[model samples]
Target: MGKIRIGVIGCGSIAKHRHLPEYAANNEVEIVALCDKVEERAAELAKEYGARSYKDYEELLKSDDIDAVSVCTPNYLHAPISIAALAAGKHVLCEKPMAISEEEAQQMITAAENNNRKLMIAHNQRFVPSHVRAREIIESGEAGKIYSFRTSFGHGGPEGWSADGKDSWFFKKEQAFIGAMGDLGVHKTDLLRYLLGEEFTEVAALVETSAKKGSTVDDSAVCVLKTESGIIGTLAASWSYVAKEDNSTIIYGEKAILRLEEDPAYSLIVQYQTGETVKYELGGIQTNESGGQSNSLVVDHFIDSIRQDTEPAISGAEGLKSLRVVLAALKSNETKKFAEI
Candidate 1:
C-alpha cells in the first residue's frame, strides 16, 4: 500500500552499485535499514540514505519499519538470510545463484509460500533491453525454431568490482560456494532460459580455477547445455578475460540468426536467411568497467511485485530452475560426464 520500506542486507559492491542505488531511485521504496557484518560499511551507507544501520541482519529483520529486504550477501548466506527474512514476514529480493544447492533454493521457495511473502531473485540480465528484444524475436517465431546458441559473460575478475577487493569472499569456496560459475555463469544460464523459454535437460562442463593466483575457486568454466526440446548450446563464464567485458549471445534458428550485445553500436542484430539484416540500437548491457552503473531493474521489479500483489518475474521457482542448470554443470564437471537436470 504505502511506500515499501526496504532493508538492504549487504553493503558490498553489489549493494553499492546496483541494489542501493536502484532501490533509492524507485519512488515506491523507502530504504529504512542498511546491514552488513562490517559495521562501518553499513553506517556509511546509512548516513547517505538516512537509514538505520545494523551489523546483524536478524536485528534488521526484526524492525517493524521494514517490509522487504534485499539479500545481497555472498552465495552461502543467500539461502539462510533469505529463509530467515521470509520467515520474518518480509519479502525478499536475493542475489543471483540463489543458493549453493537445489534443496536450499527449494527451502527458500517454501519459506516464501509459508510466510505469504514475495521471493524474487536478482537476475538482472532478464531486464536488459537487448535480452528483452531477443526474447521477443524468438518467441514471435520471426527467428523460427531455435537450433543452437552460445552465450558468455566475462570480465577480468571480481577483485576490482568486489567491495573487499582482492581479498573478497568471491575467492573463498566456503563463502562463495563456486566462483566464476556462481558469479557470471548463472547470469548467462538464466538469460538463456529466458530467451529460449525452455528448461535445460542436461549439462556437460569443464570448470577450473586456472587463473587468479591463490584462489580456491574456479575462475573459468565452459558448460554445454541441452534444452528439453533437444536444442543445444554452450555457456561460458570467466574471470580470466583480462581485456574487456564480454556479455554476448548468438542464437541460431531455422530462419534467422540473432546476436545480442555483440557490437558497441547495436546491442541486438538479426540476420534473416533471406540475405537481409536488421540491427537495433537498444541500450548497452552493464559491464564491470566504466559505464557499468546502469540500473539493473531488479530492485524496482521486486518492489513492483510486492506492491501489485503479483508473483515476481524472476520468482523463487524461476530462480530455482536456473540454479538447477548451474548445479548440474558443477556435477557434470566433477563426474566428467553428462549430468541430467
Candidate 2:
C-alpha cells in the first residue's frame, strides 16, 4: 500500500542507466537492496540510492523486507534469478530476451504461477509514446488490414556501455548466448508484437559476426517473420550500426503506412493510400535525460500492476512470446530455412 520495497539484481549498465534511476524517481517505490557479482558496483549504486548492497543475488532474494526485484543480469541469468525470486515470494521484473531458451522462459512463467507472484518483463519499448500511439492508430483501423512491417535497433557496440568495456558479458557466448539479436533484436521483436498485435509463426534469418573484432557473438542479424495473421515483416538488429539507431518500426496496411522512429527526434508519419499524409510530433514522448522517462513509465506500470493486483502491460507470457520469435530467428539462421514458431 505504501512504497513497494524493491531490490535490484545486477548493477550493470541497464540497472544504472534505466532501473535504478527510474525506480528512485517513482514515488510508490523504494529501492532497498542492490546486488551484483561485482560487489563494488552494487555498493556504488547502493550508496547513490541509500540502499543495501549484496554480492550474491541469492542473499538479496532471501531478504524479507524486499517485496520485489528487478533482474538486470545477463540473458543466461534471467530465468534462474526470476525463479529464485518467485520462490522467495518476491515479484520480479526480468529484462528482455527473457531466457536463453524457451524452456527456461517456461520455467520462469511456471515458477511465477506456482508462487502466485507477479513476473513482468522489462520490455520498455512498449512504454515509448510513439509506439503506444502507433498501436492506437493501427487499432483505430486507420492502418486498415495490416500487410507487412519492418523494424530494427542497432549501435556501435557494447564497449560504450558494458561495465567491463570490451571484456563484458555481452561478448561472451557463455554469458550472453546470442549477440545483437538478443540485445537489440529482442526490442524490435517485442515492439512489433505490441504494434501489430500478432504472434510470429515462423522466421528466416541470417546472423553473422562481421563487424566487431574478437566478439564471439553475432554483430549483425537480419530476419524475416511470418505472423499468425498472415502478415510478413523483417527485423534487422546490429551492434555495428555506426550511426546508432534506437528502435524504429514501419507498418504497411491497406489504407495507410505508419513510420515510427525513436532517435534524433521521436516522430510518427502516416501516409494514406489516397495521397494524404499526417505527421504526429512525438518529441514530447521523448523521455528526458537518458530515456529515463520511458523507463519510469515502465516501472510505474509494474508498480501499478502490483498495487491493482493486475497483470502488467508486458507480462511474463508476453515476454515468452517475444522470446520465441527471437529463438525462431536463431533457429532459422542455423538451419538456413524458415523455422516455425
Question: For candidate 1, lDDT tens digit of each residue in 103-202?
Answer: 9999999999999999999999999999999999999999999999999989999998999999999999999999999999999999999999999999
lDDT of 2: 0.87
Residue-level lDDT tens digits of model 2 in 1-341: 88899999999888888888788888999999999999899998899999999999998988899999999998889999999999999999999888999899999999999999999998888887778898998989888999999887887788777778888999989999999999989888888988988888889999999998888899899998888889998899988877644567789999998888833543888889999988887764432124443544778888889999998878989998998888888888989999998
lDDT of each: 0.94, 0.87
TM-score of every model versus the real structure: 0.99, 0.95
RMSD values for the candidates in order, in angstroms, are: 0.8, 1.9
- Model 1 clashing residue pairs (backbone): none
List ranges where model 1 is wrong by over 4 Å. none
Screening candidate 2 with a backbone cut-off below 3 angstroms (N, C-alpha, C), the clashing residue pairs are none
For candidate 2, the per-residue lDDT at 46 reads: 96
Best by TM-score: 1
Candidate 2: residue 197 Cα off by (Å): 1.2
Reference-based lDDT, residue 119, model 2: 94
